[model samples]
Target: MSAEQTQASGVVGVLESVGRKSLGLFEEIGRFFFILHATVYWTFRRPFDGKEWLRQMVRVGVDSLPVVGLTSMFTGMVLALQTYRGFERFHAEGFVASVVSLSLTRELAPVLASLMIAGRVGSSLAAELGTMRVTEQIDALYAMATEPIQYLVVPRVGATTVMLPPLVAIANGLGIFGGYAISVALMGANPVTYWEKTFQYLDLNDVSSGLIKAAVFGLILSVTGCSKGFFTTGGAEGVGRATTSAVVMGSVVILVSDFFLTKILF
Candidate 1:
């Protein structure tokens, strides 16, 4: 074959490969939505498992409180310290509380809380379900005439979705307190001024927005984690891979969706 023809063929091969990958990505997205739909549908169907749902709530929400609290606390403190430095240059150090409060309520609290949950809860769900898949427990459920989506995914996704708003609320309050501790107790900023400024710029909408974002993030992480776990293959290695993928994908989805959520909420 002529060299020109060979080069053209190579270019065509590259295009084909790109097209195939794009198609595969769309196919995966479609599958994810299908699973999400199935899980949601089965969640409200007859024979509801309130006990399992509560169990998942404790696992995903209650167990996640400590890590989320610590993360929000430290984050608020650091945010206050950093913003103070910048505001001090303009003789506006009093605005540090306002900045920290706004930042935490509008963005940091939800994003950080979600990321922590994704790391902790998402990985755990994926690993647990992956183990079940590898051990044939999922298939066993089918053998017993149980739908895995209804039995496993629905409770987890529903519980996480239900619990994340409250968690985010707690994180937001703690984050504000962290800022207050730094600004008033440590930095010697006026306590009344700090507290007053913190509330001055904040309203109900700001707090509600963060909670809304948290709920959405919870759904994303839970669905992604459960999906990864349900589809796991291979063996122990596959479980490990699913766990890692759950965390990575959950985090990515949270970060990406935050922009759009913010825009819409704003």
Candidate 2:
């Protein structure tokens, strides 16, 4: 073939491959979303499992507190320090509290906490459920007339949805405290004044918005994790793929949701 013809053919081949891959990705995403919706809908149907939901709440929420606290505290400190430098230059130093509190409560706290939870908890959930599926435990449940959707999946999803807001709120508090501590101890700022500004400028809407984002993030994490696990095949390799996908997709969704929420709310 002539050089020009060969180049054209190669370009066409690349385009075809890209198109196919994109289509496949969309298909997988659609299937996963469908399964997630079904699982959540089934969870709300019929009688509830109070005991199981409580267990999962403890597992997801209570156990996650320490890490969230540490992370948020540090975030708050860094935010304060960073904002101080810029604001001081602009003669807007007094607005530091407003900047720190608003940023954390509206954006950073929910997004960062959700991403952390996705990495730590979502991946674990996918791996655990994928293993159970591979090991025939899901089958055993089915044989015993226990709906896997209700027993195995629903509680986790419900618990995550319930737990994430609280976790985000905790993270926000810690992050603000971190900023406060740093300002007081290192920056020589008055603690009472800093806190007073924070509370004064920070309204219920700020915190409430973060909580709303947290709830959405919780849904994204749990649903994606469970979907990946439910459909996982090919044994260990499949489980690994599911775990990775769960984290990546959960993070992506969180970012996208953040963008939209910011636009709408702000």
Candidate 3:
């Protein structure tokens, strides 16, 4: 073939590839929404499985407490250390408590806790559902006259959404306490001044905003994880891939939406 013809063909091929990818992405998005819709609709249906929901909540929230706690506490400590160093130059050491408390409740606790949950609980959701998919257990649900979305997805979605707010609340408190500890014990700040400053600038609005963000993040993570797993194909490899995608996609959605949530809330 002529060089010009070959180059033209290459350009057409590239365009075709891009078009296919774009279409696939949109198709996946459609499926994701479908699952989300079905999950939400079935959530209010009769025969509410409190047993399964409580079980999943334990798995998603209680099981993940240590990871979330450590992450939030360290995040608070790091913020305190950095802010103390910087604020010391300006003779604003007292304000370190304010910064730490406000930042944790307003931003760090929810975001960090959600990301950690996505890594731990989200991955498990994807892996568990993906395995059921590949093993044909999901299909078996249909054979048994069960709505998979109701039996499987709703529990996870509900558990995640309901549990995340409380998790963020606890994380915020622990994170603030962490900041206070570091600022007072290590930095030699006045404990009374630090404790007083912590609440001086913080308000209910900041804590409420983070809790709202956490709930939304929980919805996003659970939906993404369930979507990725529910439609998983292949076998063992597909389970692993879905699990990875669940974590990555959930984290990305949480982070990107955080900016918008913060803007709207704060």
lDDT of 1 at 61: 85
For candidate 1, which ten residues in a row score worst on lDDT?
24-33
Worst 10 residues of 2 by lDDT: 31-40
lDDT of 1 at 36: 93
lDDT of the structure predicted as candidate 1: 0.92
> What C-alpha lDDT do the candidate models reach, one value each?
0.92, 0.87, 0.92
Model 1, C-alpha of 248: deviation from truth (Å): 1.3
Winner of 1 and 3 under TM-score: 3
Better of 1 and 3 by lDDT: 3
- lDDT of the structure predicted as candidate 2: 0.87
Off by over 4 Å in 3: none
lDDT of 3 by residue, 18-102 (tens): 9999998898789789989999899999879999999999998898888898899988999999999999999988899999999
Measured with C-alpha atoms, the lDDT of residue 178 in candidate 1 is 93
Clashing pairs in 3: none
| Residues 1-266 of candidate 2: C-alpha lDDT, one tens digit per residue | 69999999999999999999999799778966786777867876776889999998998999988888788889999999998888879887677887888999999998998898898889988998899999998899889988888887899888998999999988988898888887778887878888888888888988998899899889888888888888788899999999999999889988997899888876
Give the range of the ten consecutive residues with the poorest summed lDDT in model 3.
24-33
